[model samples]
Target chain A: MVPIAYYLVLSAVLFSIGVAAFLIKRNIITVFMSIELMLNAVNLAFIAFSRQWSQTTGHLQVNGQIFVFFVMVVAAAEAAVGLAIIIAVFRARNTLNVDQIDLMKL
Target chain B: MHLALFIIFAGLCVAGALNLLLQRHPINSALSLIVVMSSLAVLYLLLGAEFLAAAQVIVYSGAIMVLFTFVIMLLNAGKEERTHGSRLAYIAGFPGAAALLGLLTYIFLSHSATFGQARLGEYLATTDDISRVLFRDLLLPFEVTSVLILIAILGAVALARKEH
Candidate 1:
């Protein structure tokens, strides 16, 4: 009796939160987290739609799930490289505060 | 009820995201993000995307979150920022958050009228069917993902290398 719309709405709420956090947060780590939040929100919507259509046509609709798998793999790689970059930046700057990082202006 | 489960998962996801943003310590933030990822995997399972649920847990929580935790530990982040909370941030952050949530509610409510409802059981195909479609139809993206992963690995190494 679960409705796909419920899942979609939940995903939308998450996505909006991510967007707001990404735009407003000052800490670099917080911003990175917001990006991950957005990606997860998208994955939720994918799975919801996949389920909805599968039950309608009765043909094993796993494409959305497959896409989710790929997204997760890519997200892992991204987090690794992104954290490395953040580490390097912290090493050079001595601060993770976003406002203080203005080195490109020179 | 299924609605209750949806509410629980949604609450968990939002709570985790909020903790990630509000926690002063990078390590705590990293842990909260992992919680978010795990809850998302649970939601995926409920949605009948078992493969996605497994991948979500393995990749996001197991691998990516560990990397984030390691980086935070390595950097010793949030060691000096003793003062974490701010009254000014509460004023600005909460209003913006509330506005966004309101917008989402409006969108979903309006869209619900036009959105097509499909029966979920009709789409149940075997894993072989999924595998076949993925390999045959999505071959290009699959190969591209491999290349992307390789590049990410190389980039991480380059970033970690000591300067000569």
Candidate 2:
């Protein structure tokens, strides 16, 4: 059995990488993916804690696992809509570069 | 046995995530993110969340990432032009991120012993187990998600339509 701390630490590192990607990436899709990565990392932590808590209580718990399901569902919906929007943006602006698409800027 | 698997998969997961960041092209980054998700699924298996591991593979890496890749191909999103936007961002951002990672690691390591090792075959939430609560106690959210997906499809069609 691997220690729970290691899982948490791994989750944290993954989350930080996601953060760095989100901050550094100029492409909007990559930025969006970094957000997904961060969500996955959070899901890992939730499942790990859920397992730890479930074991301590001497029963199988379903809360954390279930939340991960909802997160996936939401991510799917977001991706569909977001990609559609990205297509629209590309059509209108002719570029996917975040810095180039500043039409909303004053 | 489990520890070794965890170490290998976890290392892959982190490396894939870093690669996702380092890649200049969005498609390359998307591919690397798939690597991260697959390794994460394995880690999820190690943690005994078999159902989520499968979902992570199917929904996340399979569906969402495919959508990302398709968009990249459709739009022909070129490699990002390297912008020397600000040296301050590098001097500031890298250290800030490192500090945040260090803080999180310190906190996790300090509290490492609070929880015990998660053993396999001990998790109670099987698919049936999850479905039971999902269909019973959490039926509303499930229904809501379906509706959300429906709305998302409609929204996508509307948004991606020609301006004619």
For candidate 1, lDDT tens digit of each residue in A23-77? 5566677678789889999888888777766766655677777777687778877
Best by DockQ: 2
Model 2, native contacts kept: 0.85
DockQ of 1: 0.48
Backbone clash pairs for candidate 2 read none
lDDT by residue (tens digit), candidate 2, B46-124: 8778888899999999999999999999888899987654466678887887898899899888887787787766774
**Two-chain DockQ for each candidate model:** 0.48, 0.78
In model 1, the number of clashes is 17
TM-score of chain A of 2: 0.95
Instruction: Tell how far residue A105 is off in model 1, in angstroms.
Output: 4.3
Off by over 4 Å in 2: B85-96
lDDT (CA) for every model shown?
A: 0.75, 0.88
lDDT of 1 by residue, B20-122 (tens): 7677666777788888889988777676665666777877888777777777777776632433334555677667767877877777667764444433333
> In model 2, what lDDT does residue A31 have?
84
